[model samples]
Target: MQHLSVARPARAILLGSAGLLLSGCSLFQSSAPQAPLPASATLPDATISYTLTGQGSMPVVFQSDLGDGKDAWDSVLPLAEQQYRVLAYDRPGYGASRKTATPRDPCTIAAQQHAMLAQAGVKPPYVLVGHGMGGLYQYVYARLYPQEVAGLVLLDPTHPDHWRRMQSDAPTSAMAIKARRKLMFTSIETVEFDAQAQCLQHIDLKTPLRMPTMLLVRDKFGIEELGSVETLVRSQEKDWQRMTGAPAIERITGAGHYIQKDNPVIVNEAIKMVVKKK
Candidate 1:
């Protein structure tokens, strides 16, 4: 039972009064281009807070890490919207979204997210962009509703069998990871992250992904804390491609767990690739 979270950094998007002004710009948050977004683009839901841009036939959905919200993608959204409609949201207890007593399992979270977008009138056959645990959530969403997802871009997503692999491959590193997740993670995180790691085991890692998919991993995956696991992690990550039907698992050099914020150009290009898929 290991739900290894990707631990994403931020989401990028610029708000313009006209809903969107799509254009390519450099991949950066501070230096990323900006546009004035209208107030209506933001929709505060009864359970979550989400921002939806444009009404294009196709939709690009952005799901953030467990600790972050839609604002995390603010820097990248501007560029993405230049070509497609996009949606970003705050899962319960992350941003303005309130926490609930509901059990925070992958299935429950996926269903809730689906309901949120459905209520917003956002159609599916979507290109999903997810980071960290958000990556896990989006993956589950695609599994539950295969017809709804057109493609997937997972940014260092939690490999469903993270803990098992760690324990089997490196026991000491697994303990350290457990302690780090419990201690270093902020208190406001609504999801019981450590506990959920076990639940991820329920998912079948070999389940074939019907849609085009890519797994983007950070170059120095475990250097920051557990350097020893680097070798083991690289080996384990290979399964993500096999499971998702991705051509290859790509690595983002000079990037951390939050590949979107560290090297957004690659992330954007991946999204573009999915969008362009027939």
Candidate 2:
């Protein structure tokens, strides 16, 4: 899930249910020099920074949460790699990659993922795994290329209705609207927070995913400032389950917003569910 709301620069603006909000995370405004990437972190041209590891017939593509790159999967990758290849990468503005001039809409983001796989010579029928806003992107990919996606695993994914539900859920609608407006230019990646909200409004959700799908939600979705919003959150989770035919969103105990980091067992288990479908 990604966030967009009033400017709370002190900490991440945690309003929208998109789940990109974090307490200590900083919103980067420029393409400042990032720490040197490991030599193994590879990508051709200016496509993106990614690491393709392991050797197997099928590939498990990993898409990280907003403002996060591949490192988010650092702990859980080995388990996934035991059976399949893994391709994890920075979207555009995060990690070692630079922000793209292209609009960060869902359609654009989906095409970018396809292009990245093509550039890497990684073929179709991929087991797509995404966290937070990344989940939305992978969902779009599955929609755009159903035959190519074997399965899907959504870890605390941003519900398609995240923005609209957020504005209505909070005590004041203005709070959530202001949050999106404030961060639009402050963080290069947050640009998509607005882009997604606007574009997703027009995207078709009537078509259900035919592939095996898994939806996992954190025990708590980190936005505590908005009082008594659990019901709203549950509604969002239910919508995801209904749309994608994902199982009920079980509340993962001992898991935070980053469920993959806090509990890799659940994440790997979900991945296994879809991979086994093959």
Each model's TM-score?
0.79, 0.80
Predictions: Cα RMSD each: 8.6, 7.9
> Weakest 10 consecutive residues, lDDT, candidate 1?
14-23
34-124: candidate 1 lDDT, tens digit per residue: 3533222222333776777744577889987766778768667877776678888877777777766666777777878888878777888
Best by lDDT: 2
Q: How much lDDT does each candidate structure score?
A: 0.66, 0.69
Candidate closest to the true structure, highest TM-score? 2
lDDT for 64 in candidate 1 is: 79
Give candidate 2 regions above 4 Å deviation. Answer: 1-19, 23-46, 171-186, 223-228
